[model samples]
Target: MSQRPRPCRWLRRPGSDLGLRLTLAAAAAVLLLVPFTVLMLLVATAWPPLLALDAHLAATLHAGTSANPALAGVLQLWTDMFAPGPLRVLVGVVAVWLWWRGARRVALWAVVTMVAGGLLGAGLKLLLGRDRPEFLDPVSHATGYSFPSGHSLTAALGAGVLLLIFLPFVPDASPVRTQRATRWTIIAAALIVTVATGLTRVALGVHWLSDVVAGWTLGVAVIAATTAAFATWRGLPARRSPQGGSGRPPPRDMPGRT
Candidate 1:
């Protein structure tokens, strides 16, 4: 009789995979904190050069968009679609689906990342107490301290959560044409939504370039940190199973499974 495959030892104890998890955590921290810290300091001090650039870009985009009604309308529509509220709702639905599918860790990660990103952005905003740029003829308005754009942060968090959770299901090499096409399509779509969400906030006169940039950085950091934690929980070198390559524990080993 053939022997059953042994469970990966690393998955059972986090200490076994300490080095890899620490590396991932450190890299994520540096990427998130270094530039984000510098940006915060510059904004706090109201650095002349940074402020000038912020004002110039904000004004230029506002002017161009104001002149072209159709372009402005499009930007507005894009922003509304990816706004924090809608993104949060979408993430919530995704979390529910993941939970039902028995990928509980992934579902929890998604919720935690999204909530953490939003709270971080909101906390920083209150700390800085920054004001939104004022335009004589404003194309749009957002109420909040504007050092970090909420919409951008939410979009990035939502997109990152969905991408990481679903990516493992998409085969790297598939014989089916539709399956192969979907490989890159998901990644490209995520990028477009995240980037466009930030751009629209600036173009709409609702947020500064720095605000949008900070949001993107913070959101990505939260996603990375949470993802690393979950990866550590599940162990590295994810198991391959009939369902697909997944970080999730095998259904047979899962809690409450028969």
Candidate 2:
């Protein structure tokens, strides 16, 4: 009769398997981000028309700018801070702080993702060399070529990094995904911060809808790649130390055995 290997005395079943499962999920998620990256690549082709998309988005906002005053106010705050100013700096600091607390690897990934997004957006903007809105009343003022909005790029990068920071910790309950309250809360916060901040660009009249989409695409791709790398590294469980220093002795309780 075959016998099952006993669960390691020191090993916690679900938590121990978590790294491997998360790595797989991160890999799968990275595959998903590829299409988004392609779309961002296509931004070069479609960028010229973004002025029109911006106009449409602006018209919609202008038509009924404040359906939910409270919500509008919240969104307004985001719009005000869409630039690479003090607010941006504050956000950057918070993101870095988050990465340092529980997961240094993740925090580093966030920084990489942001830098990647910024560089990608800059290159695309220069290549496209597109013009800004012909007639403008943007909530935020902008100069130079416009297409993939820098504001949107930074926001997406920030959000993507935040999501990556939080994703692994969530109680996935499905073999690998951990679900802890703090993780879920942070995940929700990250999504809110990213989406809200990205939209602020549109409201402020700086970026077209297409620009945000592209930024989101590129940002997600960068983050996915970062997460995939982390996942790959973490997939391997820690080996029991020499002399089994890290290993725990067999459990005192045995099934149907005294």
**In model 1, where do residues sit more than 4 Å from their true spots?**
1-18, 176-181, 235-258
lDDT of each: 0.79, 0.57
Tens digit of per-residue lDDT, candidate 2, span 1-258: 422222111112235656666666576557756765565565656655644666788667643544445655666677666554543465467555644443344444455556666777788889778665433434446686776677666766665554554454333344433445566677777677667767776665556666677666666666666555655544444558688664644322211112
Q: Can you tell me which runs of candidate 2 are displaced by over 4 Å? A: 1-34, 37-43, 46-54, 62-76, 82-103, 136-139, 166-185, 233-258
> Model 1, residue 200: displacement in angstroms?
0.5
Across residues 1-258, which tens digit of lDDT does each residue of candidate 1 receive?
A: 422222212122346557776577659867897898899999999999999999999999999999999999999999998999999999899778767755566667778889888888899999999999899998988897998889888988998877776655664355778776785798899999999999998999989999999988888888877766765665556567686767564543222343
lDDT of residue 230 for candidate 2: 50
> Each model's RMSD to truth, in Å?
7.1, 9.4
Q: What TM-score fits each model?
A: 0.82, 0.60
List clashing residue pairs in candidate 2: 139-204, 170-178, 170-179, 171-178, 171-179, 171-180, 172-177, 172-178, 172-179
